[model samples]
Target: MKMQKTNKWILIYGVIAALLIALHYVLQLSVFEVWNEYVPFLEKLSMSLFLIALIFMVSKIIRKLINTRAHLEGDRYNLLRITRLLAIVSSLIVATSFLFQNLYAAVVSFGLISLIIGFALQAPITSFIAWIYLIFRRPYLVGDRIQINGLRGDVVEINYLDTTMLECSGDYLVNDRRSGRIIRFPNSLILKEEVINYSGPDFPFIWNETPIQVAYTSDLEFVEECLLAATNRDFREHYRHFAAHEWEEWEPAVYFRINTYAWMEAVISYPVEPRDTTGRRNRILRYALALLNEAPDKVQFPEGTLR
Candidate 1:
């Protein structure tokens, strides 16, 4: 398999080299003829050699740019920076080529050829442009948990064609939340889909819930107080900043209700860092249980309840 792959690559490279050589010779025969009268063969050769050298140099720079872009995985900022740099370099080259009228005319005449090439790569170019917008606007960032067009994941990379992710939720495996599978999402989706950023600048914390049940016979007010106290103790420091921020707009509160089914419902509502939600919920549950254990008889479940 490895040998076959190596041979295939060699064949492709050979074909490309042959094409480039053919193009160089064809251009030399056709274009250099006009200039041969004004410039000696040696000088023309030197100029031809320089143009060839420039093309190779540009090719090398393009390869490096592509490789550098590959490293910008999940980082929108770096991706945009690399893209802008490439655009600038490409523009400069095109502009410089225009300085030579004959060459410029020749290049312009080849616009149909360029158009054909552009048409062939329309999808990738469109995706790249969307990527540029994503980078500048920063709808999401690396490590941000987001749901876009029904796909949920932690973004792992942002590339030319697609953004890669470590899947978090959706139709995929449940409880295998830490599954190492990587997903590549096309950049074009940014234009077509609604992207929900779970960890955007404004809302870094997710609203978490910890539900507790107690007997209807328990002192309702007292259970509420105990539950609130437990929640405040376990998550106060963690949620304090967001709470304070929320307070500016609306008061933060933990809601409790006695369901019609004769169960005291203590729903501890709080904001938690999206990534730490699972662990934070566990801690809050443990604290709440400890608080309940202190008042065992008082906190007993309704008699005959299987739960």
Candidate 2:
């Protein structure tokens, strides 16, 4: 549908250009006639339209190429952005060059104009610069879950001045589920605020802990064993091969802690994929609870009241 629209406009421009050329010959309109200065203006206008149509056609082709060749979403998006930027810049340069007969004068004038615009649009310029920094620094890329300042979400788009995120945890929700709200913040904020990225080379797994409270009289060994059993059942297959090669020394472990209410706290520490944190924790807790129920005499959970 979009391609059809583009082709339609291109055809219109081609027809107009052909008509303009035919007009010059058919009407015998001289470029320097007494009252026919409109002749040259019409020619220039026609040429501009033709150039714009050509640019759009080229841009569309390049976009298709990028979409086909660039495997990663982020890479495809960035490449398309660059392509559009180049098209706009090139069109501006061509139009300006046509407008000004003297090339050097045009260059000098553009430089001064850009300097003035730079100072006038300080905030926007800063954001654009920050965008460049983001491209190189890669604090967070598209699809990466991140928390900047207090906002937490997956980056959906990174525009020239604004970064759009699909928010995860909003006011009502505490878990890491999507809130269906979107947030757009200035790119310049990256320079001012700390960015916490939950995705990286140690991807598909992040350190997570689940604390299980048991009565002080419970067998500590039994509690530890139950915690380990639940965790191993859920995560061992996922992490076993990668864990040994990527992180040679790290393994799932259970640590014991003393609670203020005299209850024994069993902290099950393990690695979990960011998206699976809540679900995995829920499963582990259910498994632990079911197993503890089987041996109630050995492992008892803390009651609501301290004593």
Task: Find the candidate with the highest TM-score and give its number.
Answer: 2
lDDT of 2 by residue, 1-307 (tens): 7556656665665666566556545444553476475666665655665666567657767776676678877767777887888888778765776687445766887888899999899999999999888877778778778899899988899898989999887897988888999999999999999999887644657788999888879888988888888887876655566645655344679998888886878899988777667888898998888888899899888777674
Give per-residue CA lDDT, model 1, range 85-197, as digits (tens).
66555544544454444456647656755688789998888888887787778777777788888778888677767898898744655532545667788898998899988
Give candidates' CA RMSD values in order. Answer: 9.0, 4.3
Candidate 1, run of 10 with poorest lDDT: 244-253
The estimated TM-scores of all candidates read: 0.64, 0.80
Off by over 4 Å in 2: 1-44, 236-250
